[model samples]
Target chain A: MQSEFAVELRDVVKQFVTPEGNLLNAVDHVTMQIKNGEFFSMLGSSGCGKTTSLRMIAGFEWPTEGEVYIEGKPMGHTPPFQRKVNTVFQNYALFQHMTVYQNVAFGLEMEGADKNEIEKRVKRALEMVQLTGMERRKPRQLSGGQQQRVAVARALVKLPDVLLLDEPLGALDLKLRKEMQLELKALQQELGITFIYVTHDQEEALTMSDRIAVMSKGKVMQMGTPVEIYERPANRFVADFIGESNFLEGKIKSVSADEASVFVPALNAELSGVPMSKDFVNGEEVVISIRPEKIRIVDADAEKDGVFRAKVINSIYIGSDTHVFLDCNGVRLKVMEQNHISRLDPHSFYHKDQAVGVYLIPENTLVLKKEA
Target chain B: MLQRLRENKAWQGTLLALPTTLWLFVLLVIPLFLTLVVSFGRRSPDGGVIYGFSFHNYLRLIGYSTNCPAGQSACFDPLYAQILWRSLTLAFWTTVIVILLAYPLAYFIARSHPRRRNTFLMLVLVPLWTNFVIRVYAWMMLLREQGVINGVLGWIAAQFGLPFQPLQMLYTPGAVLVGMVYEFLPFMILPIFTSLEKIELPLYEAAADLGANPFRTFLRVTLPLSMPGVVAGTILVFIPVMGTFIVSDLLGGKQVILVGNLIQNQFLSARDPTFGSAASLILMIMTLIVTYFYTRKFGFGEEIITA
Candidate 1:
């Protein structure tokens, strides 16, 4: 029977011995399931166990506690060569001595494929990466981007079930990295193979991944779609990591099916219709996460239920939006407004220390669990 | 003035090269020119130079002889030809054996942990701290018929109440080869170790992830990448083994004569400076020819050193 999941990690743990003679868990009990043909990403900073998790899936490392399943088969201490998966390294580890053709054909040659079949597959692989007619060049002779393409082509030529990428675009410049991001996403869709990417860049993960697992200190913080992760984060750590959030510490007063009323001490008022991540008990401590774009500036004298008076400290007018920094009582909050009107009028922008009325939309406000 | 001097790159280059240029001219160029001039001139009766040009020395070196046997007008002596061929063969074997032994040892040291690798490298270099001749004498103590090796075997035989005779191991071609390999083994190991250590760990992972077994990864990735070191080690071991006479003199006794022995005999024992100069010129030309071909096929291994 064919399994629905392409890869599964069941409570996997990896422990390492530190130089100071202490045992440390590099991968702490991470369990995740990546669907077939899905683009799954592990997002975290360095030493956050993202790369270690990818290595376990590729069989370069075996879990210390649980098991890793590839295509529903238990992968227990299997060597990398025996596994049907490939990895695109962070450094684009192309063979320096071999020509592009030879490097791309290496896997086929190891399998003892016929000469004609190897040539056909290698040419097609190079063409897919847009490296045609450059087969005679060694890796050192090519530019960094071209070498990275060769690495991708070398891994893709094998046509494995899952492809693991460990920050493959880390070495490229910003413009090129952005371009390759789109190209990689397109390639994944065209080939319809499962991709397990590891990276610390939040924007790259948000733009390309079908589902993302935010990891910190060897533990999975949260896993969800980009919209869910950005709009309604599971906890304070997820809210703070995925994007900028102004947190207002509060206590739950009442809860319904989808919304809850939280009494925020900083604002000295009760916030109603706040989206609840999970059911909360009465008087439990929580944090209300409000995105900068969700707040709007109204007339200072307007009478609104959720409106508060604040003094603008600074305003920065970028091309598409204007960032207004304000201080309400003792708490500082940032408000982002789109530059939809008054492009050339300097009078329309908020000045320093100018009094303004801040309105918070309860629909966009999220109630998260307070982190210790 | 300082700014102008700094701006002039040509002047800076010339000033930097001045000392080494003068040193090479005085120490190397003049001696080589003198050797070339003496190779073409004639030898006087009392082992003195005669200022006259002739092709007699070159012709005699290729086997033409003036001192023919009593029945013949002219004869061909194959002594110098045989000695040159023997020296080439000995150098070739010594280089091959050294590479076989050094590559594995170098790999072991390069793959070892960082703290222990230093200790292993120091052990490889420890033998070089003693004098070269003294170390060769140490080998003599081990290889001699009545020395340590034979003495151990003889004692073992006496314990069993059996008649035993010591094997003849010293003063043979085999002993000379052992001495040459022992002296040049480090030269082979160091360069190979440098190249092997410079390889990034990710390349091995890439190879394995692309469906290559451990042995295939070594052949396809490790061996091809470390070739520059092998080339450098061969050059260092071969050139010195070609011109060394002391090892042969001590180990080969009078059985195996090489081109170095022939040249030494010409200058010291035979008192023929002209023939010795001719032999020296031939040895230099042959070494240059072999080195040229070898480097043209493989690189000069400069990348291995700099990398």
Candidate 2:
């Protein structure tokens, strides 16, 4: 039977000895399955093994243990040229001597494609990347974005089963990076080829990936859809990494099948939320995590059961939103309150030394078992 | 003192460059100018410069010897012309063979494991640590009629019950060519290795990702990228081989006579400094012309050359 996954890493471990002679797992025993036609991303900071995992899938690296499967075939130390996958390197490693057209035609010619076919496909691939009139320009003559497109075209002209991109847009300016992110997403969907993108930018991963695998210290922490990853992060690391979260030390007051109530010492109260990962017994120490935007600012006079009186410490206006820092029940909490007005209104914004009420919705608040 | 010099950067640079400038001007430019002046002067009766303008030396170089039996003003003699031609061909062939021999070794060292790469590069440079003439003498020891090679071959032939004869391997044009190739091989290898090593690892992976096998990658990526290094090595090897005389003198045993040997003989035994000056100027011009065209086509491969 045909496999559902375009690529699968089963208990993959890539070990490396440091220059200091310490054995380190560059990629731990991590297992993940990327489905066909999915824009899957391995996202993390540097040394997180995301790039290593991508390299293993691209066949640039081999797993020290377990196997990597591409299109239902176990890739046992297969060299990169023999594999049916192409890569867009982080540096956009275009052959400097080859022109844009030749860069795109390289794969076809290597596969022994006919001259006319190579020309036709090269032209089409350039057009797809909107680099049609730059056939004769060397890679040095093109801009970073154009060079990136050439790298993509060079890989995609082969019509591989999958395309692996390693931080392809990390070098571009912010505006161009954002534009290319959408363009790459559209291209992936249009061609319906699996794209395995590796990036350290969480926003890029969240914005483009159909599913994301957040990794740290060579281990896969969580793999889920964008909404799932952002809304229900797996643990303290994931919660702090994906976006932003406020962690308050707490202990479990009550535990249900999925929901749990944690008594936070900071607020001297209990908050209920669904447990993010495993089971939690009563009196177990936990972390009550909530995003900055999840907390609500209430009227001081409002009668809310979960409202805690707070003093506004500082407010920073960042055009789209106002960041309000409040001292609530001896814990400093940050609140990202969206601005509904067209322009900045200092009167609407909370000034320092003003009294306010802070309320945490139990559903938005998360309980993470604190690591030792 | 450094802080004071830093206040005027251009002055500091001039001060820094003073020694090399004085050295080149006194040793190189003055000698070249003197050679140019002497090339135009006539030979004195006492075998010194007569200090008179004449075109005889230049004309005589192009086969116009006035000392013919007919007492002619100018006549053709193919001896010097033949030596010049032979030198050109020898330099060209030596450079070609050295490139063919150097590229693989350079590529091997460039592709070797990083920890051992320095060791391989050192091995390539080891022969240079010996004095250049001594190195040539070492080749002579190997290529002489009863040298180690022929002795080994004769031993093998005797064991096989075949007639054993010492081959005439010494003092031939082939011996000179071998010596020339051995002497200049390192110059070519070093620059080529530098250029090949400068090609990042990602480039090879990018080629492989594009479906290029190792051979195809070498053909398309490795070969083209390393052209700068090859050009640099060619400049390093070809110019020196053209003007070099020691290997030819020691190995050729009068069988091979290049422009270098011609110039040397004219200034020394022949006692004709004017002719030597003209020949030296001609060699310099030829070397510069080739270098100009070659660099225009490729590049300086500046890193290693400047270093």
Best TM-score goes to which candidate? 1
Candidate 1: which stretches are off by over 4 Å? A341-345, B1-4, B300-307
Give candidate 1's TM-score.
0.96
Go through the candidates in order and give the clash count of each. Answer: 0, 0
Local accuracy of candidate 2 as per-residue lDDT tens digits, B95-165: 99999999999999999999999999899889999999999999888888889899899999999999988
Candidate 2: misplaced stretches above 4 Å? A273-278, A342-347, B1-45, B48-77, B145-168, B285-307
Record all residue pairs in model 1 with backbone atoms less than 3 Å apart, i.e. clashing: none
Give the candidate number with the greatest lDDT: 1
Candidate 1 lDDT over A1-372, as tens digits, reads: 668999999999999988999988889999999999999999989999999999998888889999999999999999999888999999988888788998899988888899999999999999999999999998999999999999999999999899999999999999999999999999999999999999999999999999999999899999999888898788888888888898889999999998999998889999999999798988989999999998989988888988999999999999899999999877899999999897698798899999999998899899988982
State fnat for each of the candidate structures.
Answer: 0.73, 0.77
Indicate the residue-level lDDT of B92 in model 2: 90
lDDT by residue (tens digit), candidate 2, A174-198: 9999999999999999999999999
TM-score of each: 0.96, 0.89
DockQ of prediction 2: 0.46
